[model samples]
Every structure is written in C-alpha cells, then in structure tokens.
Target: MTYRMLALSIDGTLLRSNSRLSRQTKDAIEYVKEKGVYITLATERPFPAAKKIAKALKLDNVLITHDGGFIASDVDEPLLSRKLHEDKTFHIAEILENYKCHIRLLHEQFSIGNKVRQKNQLIARMTLGIQDPLYYPVTFVDSICEHLMENPVAPPKIQAQFFSAEEAQAASMELQKEVPSIDTIVRGERLEIVPKGISKARGVQVVANHLGISLEQVVAIGAGVNDIDMITQAGLGVAMGNSPEELKASADWITRSNDMHGVAYMVKEVFRKQLKVNI
Candidate 1:
C-alpha cells in the first residue's frame, strides 16, 4: 500500500523497557523519512514528555498526546484539543476521592496531581515539582478535587494510580458507569481517563486529514490496548512482539520486541520490500 505516514505509540512500542531509544530504531525512522514518510507519535503522555522523544527523533510533525485528547506540535498552538469538561472533572475527582489513589490532571502547559496519600513515595515527591523546558510542568496539592473546585480547569486527561489491580478495575468500572462522556484506559495499576472519541485511530485520521493523506496510506505501530484501534484502522497495523495477545491479534503483522529493535526491523524489512530494494 504506498504508505505515507507512520503513526507510532510511545511507551511500550517505541521505547525499550528501560526507556531508551535504540540506535537501530533511530536509523530506521530516518530511513523511512528519507523515503518521504511522515512520522507522528501517538502517545498517552502529555505533550512535553512526548515532545522530548519527538525532538530526539527530529520529527517535525504534530503528535497525538493524552491519547488523542490533544494534538499539536507546540503546546501553545494545537490542531485539536479535547478536554474533560470542568463540571465533569469536578465530579470525576469527587468520585476518585472515594478511593485510595494518586490523582493527576494533565493540561497542555502543565499537570496538577494530588499529594495527599503519596507523601511517602520518593518518586512521587520528586514528581511534584514544576518542571519547565526540561520536562512538563507538574505540581502537587493536598486535594485535586479541592484544587479543581477553586481553579476550575478543563484538562485533557485525568489519571489515577491505585494500590492494586482490583482497586483500579473497580474504580474504572465505577467511573465508566457514572461518567458516560469519558473513556478509561487501564495500564497495570494506573487508570487514564480521557473524553470520548479520543482514540489513537481518531488521531491518525486527524493527522492524515491535516496532511492531505488517507488512512490507507498510513502504517500504525503500537503495543498497548490504547493502540488497538489505531493499529486496526491503519492500512498496515504492526504489533510489537512484546505486545499483549489482544493487540497482537489486531495487528496485520507482528514485529520483534522493542528490545530486539522491532521498529528498526519492521521499517527496513517492509519499506524496503515496498521499494523493491535488494537490501
């Protein structure tokens, strides 16, 4: 299919387990870029965190962050931004307080999280600081609901880190039932909440439309549940070897594990074949 765009999920698909980008993967992306294929990061991370990797990869295209709730190259200028309504945020935070978890509200410019119960965790303490150009700004308050009650923000995403998988599942279920306008994504004990119609597939369509391309001319690669729709809807959907069975089943092809340079292998092998190159 003469693919023109390569949409990649960041966390488990592009980065190795240790969060490092391999040289082979860098080369692979450059190779495809030389062939005129546009690359975009389809991630659940905020723009600053995602933008760091995009800058490292030297991608000039826009990124789909907050699980497609926000799409933009710069935080100040966004092509698309879908945030949880202020009233809904208030209700969601109120519901979250009923459970034991670390809550975070992700905004394009900064993030606000709760520090009520996570005071003992060292990492959590360090994450409370407001970072700037170095990292996305994040701050902590005693109560997210209280902060929201006073500040009243419509954030792109809300996250909760529960102590157990069971608790996470239960909270997710409750949120789903109570809030009909939101979508909940579970990754281990972390629950990510975003507004509806904010899947990576929709982000792909947004990027495609902006670039004057079609979904059939895109190659979607990912390794998580959030990526399932993007992988299925693209012309060529690739799942990493390390991906869960559900994602693997949805993929048109499965590449090597991220640690084994899966992205490098897939791009060189497939794009080379498409170009009819002997290499």
Candidate 2:
C-alpha cells in the first residue's frame, strides 16, 4: 500500500528507555519526510510536552496530542479538540480521590494538579522525568475537585498516577461504571480520562480527513494500550518490541524494541520496501 502518513506514539515508541531520541531514529524520520511521507505524533501528553519533540523532529504535520483530544500543528489552530464537561471533570476527580493517586487536569496549554500525595510522589517524579518539556506549565491547587467546582472549566483530559498498575486498573473499572460518559484507559500505573468517543484513532482520522487521505493510506506505530485503536484502525499497524503482549497480538508487524532503534528499523525494513515498490 502507498502509505501517506506515519502516526507515532511518543513514550515507548519513539523515545528510548531513557526518554531521549536516538540519532538513528532522527535520521530515519528525516529520510521518510524527504520521501514525502507525513509524520505526526499521537500521544496522551498535552501539547506543550508533545510540541517539543515534534519541533525537534522538525515535523510540520498537525499533531495528535492529548490522546487525540487535541490536534494541531505549532502554527495552526486545533483542527479538533474534545474537552470534558465541567461536571464530569469534578465527578471524575471525586472518584479518583478515594485512591492513592496524583491527579492532573490537562488543558490545551496548561495543566492543574493538587498538592502531590506523599505515596504517589515517586510517580510524579517519574512522569516529570519523561515529560520534561522546558516550558510546560502546571498549577498546584489545594483541592483539585473543589478548585474545578469553583472554577468550572472544561478540560481536554484528566490523568491519575498510582503506585501500582493494579490500583490504576481498579480505579479505571470504577470510573467506567460510575462515569460512563467518559473514556478511561489504564496505561501502566496511569489512568487517562477523556470525553466519550475520543481516542487516538479518532484524532488520526481527523488529520487524515484534513489531508484528503483515507484511513487505508495511513500507518500507525505505538507501544501502549492507548494506541490500540489507531493501531487497528490504520492501514498498517506496528507494535514496538517492548510493547505489551496484548498490543503485539493486535499489531500487523512487530519491530525492534524502542531501545534497539525499532522505529528506524521498521522504516528501513517495512516502509522503505513499500516506497521502493511504489517507485
């Protein structure tokens, strides 16, 4: 198939385990762009965190950030953005407060969180290490739910980090039952909540439509459960070697793990082959 675009997940797909980009991956991306293949990042990260990587890669396409809740480039207005209702945001925060978790409410440009819990401070530190954008802004309130109740503004996404994946899953199940109007995805020790029917796949579809391409002409590569929809929805779906077994089961192909320069290998082995045939 003559693929026109590549949608990549940031955390475990493009970055190495240390959360840094490798020269091999950067060179591969440049090669693909030179060949006229569009590249964009599909991540659960907010725009400020994701934009830094996009700019480093020099990708000009509209980015699918906030787990597909926000789509835009550095220059253009968001093509699509799905924000949670004010009531739902507060209710979700209320439910999460029962657990030992660090909660964050994400907006297009800034995020708000309450005082970090002692137990979950490690999770917060880990997240800080990974999402280390120089200019990403965050505010700390005393009570996230109460603050949102008083302020009453819709947010693009709500995220919670737990000490264990089990706690994250338990909270996710409860959110699903109590808050059916939102979509909850448990990725490792973190749980991400967004408006119903919003996902990376949906975000990629919006970008495809804007580019006048069909789903069958797009390629998606990811290493997380949040990426499953786009992996299955894209014309070609690739899972990284470090991806969980479930994601690997759903992938059309499995490349090397992110640390091993899997993305570059996939581009040279899979995408390059197709491009060569087309030529």
lDDT by residue (tens digit), candidate 2, 145-250: 8888678868889888887999999999999999878888887898889999888899889998888888888889999877888999999999999999999999
Tell me model 1's lDDT, rounded to 2 decimals: 0.85
Off by over 4 Å in 1: 118-134, 273-279
TM-score of each: 0.92, 0.89
- Relative to the true structure, candidate 1 reaches a TM of 0.92
Highest TM-score: which candidate? 1
Query: lDDT (CA) for every model shown?
Result: 0.85, 0.84
Point to the candidate with the largest lDDT: 1
What 10-residue stretch in candidate 2 is worst by lDDT?
A: 119-128
